[model samples]
Target: MEAAIAVLVAQFKAFAGADGSTDTLSKGEFQNLVTSQLPNLVKNSADPAVIEQLMSSLDQNDDGELTFLEFWQLVGRLANQHGGFSR
Candidate 1:
C-alpha cells in the first residue's frame, strides 16, 4: 500500500514538475499525466465504455484532469478493493 502510494506520488511529482508539486498541474496537464501514467492499470479497461466511465467517475472535476485529492481517492479505493491496505 505504501509502495503504491509512493509510486503514485512520484508519478504526480513527475507530471507536475521537478519540484514535486501537485499545485503546478493544470487541468489539461493532469489529464495528460493520467493518460501517460496509468497505462498499466487502465490498459485493459473497457472501450469508450470503461475509459469513459472511469474518466467521469474518477476525474471528479470533469476538467479532463485529476486533482491530487481525486488521485489519492482512487488509490485508496483500489487499495481497499485489493486488500492492499486497511484504514
Candidate 2:
C-alpha cells in the first residue's frame, strides 16, 4: 500500500514537474501523462478533444491546471474501476 501510494506520488511529480511546476499539471503535461502512462487505463488516449474534456473535468479550480489533489481524484477513480469497486 505504501509503495503504491509512493508510486502515485512519484508519477504525479514526474509529470507535474515537466513544466517546472511540481505542484500542478498543465494541459500538455496531463495529456502526455495520460497518453503515455495511462494509455491502457484511460479511454480515448489518442483523442485530443477527449483529453481536453478530461482535463477540464479534473481542473477543479478552472485554472487550466491540475493540482495533486485533483490528479488523485483520477487515480482514485481509476483504482476503483480497475478493482471492480465502482458501481
What TM-score would every model get versus the actual structure?
Answer: 0.53, 0.94
How does model 2 score by TM-score? 0.94
Pairs in steric clash, model 2: none
- Overall lDDT per candidate, in order of appearance: 0.63, 0.91
User: Per-residue lDDT tens digits of candidate 2, residues 1-87?
Assistant: 999999889999999999898999999899999999999999997799998888888888899999999998898889999999998
Best by TM-score: 2
| Count of residue pairs whose backbone atoms collide, per candidate | 0, 0
> Per-residue lDDT of 2-82 in model 1, one digit per residue for the tens?
997788777777787633555545544555665666655555443455555665677766776566787677666665756
Candidate 1 residue pairs in backbone clash: none
